[model samples]
Target: MKRNLLFSCLIIVCSSVQAIPISLEYQGFYQRLKQVNKGHYSQVELVFSVPNKEKCRIQSGNISTEKESFPLIITKEQRLFLPFDEKLKSDRALINLDIQGETKHCNIAMQVRAKQTKMEYTHGDIVEIQAEMNAMLSEMQGFPMRYFTTDIAGVSFLFEADSDVTVNIDGVVQSVSGKLRLSRAQILTLTNLKLSLKPKVISPWTNGD
Candidate 1:
């Protein structure tokens, strides 16, 4: 009985850490508006909020359409997720956003890597890097963006071929693809993802508020 109980306990612990939590929430800049179908090239924005160790401040950041966005925040007990559809992943665009209340800002030229791959995420030490891929606009620098979170277990971002925009990862180039999305416990990933040139990811005029 003792041996059996020990084995069961070990299995539980292992399983608990094996399957990392991944949740995603999809929001657009037109959340409170409406518009008509223009095209794939449209201004888009996503905000990711998480629990902060320190209080007295908001727990959210904006990822605009002016630059790449990544290095999603994931703490020890929680992970954030951002799942991108095939259409947007393949087409890249400029990503930009503000940290909110802070003077820091991100303006990156991003695009998708022409490759196909996936990854296995679990509880472990994680480092972040801003991965930038831009086939157009030669004047921009392609590199990792500033890390907004720490003590992460795993991280991922998917970019499709048709995605004609820049995408900056907060850490190393984990994976690259023309189709993908983010997954986390609370979906706190993706601070903001707005587009500089576009017909709008979510048309407020057509989609409605």
Candidate 2:
């Protein structure tokens, strides 16, 4: 019978060539440490979810850490930036995704925190005269003056000065100097400072055991 229809068409072409046209999922990854000008910059953010409708194309990725091995540049709106090193001592990382041709692997875990603040001044060049005497004594003592503040990951100043205040280190300046002793209308404040990134675990990439 045509040799059993040519052995059932070679078992349906080897089961559609072992089927696996893309179905990788591990949609999470993050790491960011910033403190520029004084030098310190690190960033890593990768997310994937290609449920496979057929259009697959993301042909490169890698970010193994235990010493170093970062190389993942894919942007044109595809998004996946990972090459801004310096400040990743280790919090666990091992991601590799090369979609389309197949090659997925992940095991990420990071929860680092380093939002610093240190102040001390007696005359570090008078720190802009104690930030203009703490914004004119916080608008004539009406309050709402943390000696200068702004969010979105930048700008914070509270001075009383004794040292370490030269200014213009850029990276959105976050200076806090103190020797504690003001009277040009005294005003100094700091509350709820912040910076964060948490991605406990996102392991999911298996197909070949």
Candidate 3:
């Protein structure tokens, strides 16, 4: 009887440990970075692809580097954003997500490779930038999407978009890719620089059905 009881307990523990949640894949990018009064702030957009038809409620999340961990704030729409220290020491970070209905944690390894360019104030340059930003905003409005922002110095803007955008940085043409969503602060940041907007396009596939 004692042996049987021990075997039963071991089986239960093994089964619980093996019952991990389905892994979710996500693509993240830096949308923008700007200089503030005392320091600089940045924003990153993460697009998550939930497995099967499972719904994800982001109970909590964090970004971990080699030295420190930064907590992330998630909006009702599932967008995540956070601020980091001035000396961002790593290009690679680990994202840990604590969601409901999972015994084990769901994690993703993401590459922080989004385009970053300084703003130019030339009349023609500003006009072109404004037009592009406006078009992106108009397209993303009213879509069920997530948004996040971070206030960290020295980290460049990166993001993953549904489509690709062409940008010229110091005379070099480059492409930025990701699904775009703009926070009110992000919109204001662009407006203050006189270069307004970003992108998002809604599709039936996004519903996760």
| Candidate 2 vs 3: which has more lDDT | 3
Question: What lDDT is obtained when candidate 3 is compared to the true structure?
Answer: 0.32
Candidate 1 local lDDT, residue 112 = 19
Listed in order, each prediction's TM-score against the native is 0.17, 0.16, 0.29
| Best candidate according to TM-score | 3
Please write out the lDDT profile of model 1 over residues 1-209, one tens digit for every residue: 11100100110111121222222222331221111112122222222223221211223432323245544443332222334433323334212222222211111111212122223221221111211111111111121222222222212333334555333333333333343333333124444332222211110110110
lDDT of 3 by residue, 1-209 (tens): 11100001110111222323232212122221211111211222213322211333456667666677777676664554544333332345555555554432222211122223333334343333333333332333333322112221111222333556554433445555653323333334342221122423221111111
Error of 3 at 49 (Å): 9.9
- Candidate 1: global Cα-lDDT? 0.24
The runs of at least 3 residues in candidate 1 whose Cα sits more than 4 Å from the true structure, single-residue gaps closed, are 1-79, 93-98, 101-209
Tens digit of per-residue lDDT, candidate 2, span 1-209 = 11100101110111222223332122222222221212221221113232221333455666766677667666543444444344433435555555542222211212111222333323332333334323322232222212122111112233333443433221234433431222322213322222121212111111110
Model 2 clashing residue pairs (backbone)? 119-176, 119-178, 120-162, 120-178, 121-161, 121-162, 121-178, 122-161, 122-162
Which run of 10 residues does model 3 get worst, by summed lDDT?
A: 3-12
**What is the C-alpha local distance difference test score of each model?**
0.24, 0.29, 0.32
Please name the candidate that would achieve the greatest lDDT relative to the true structure.
Answer: 3
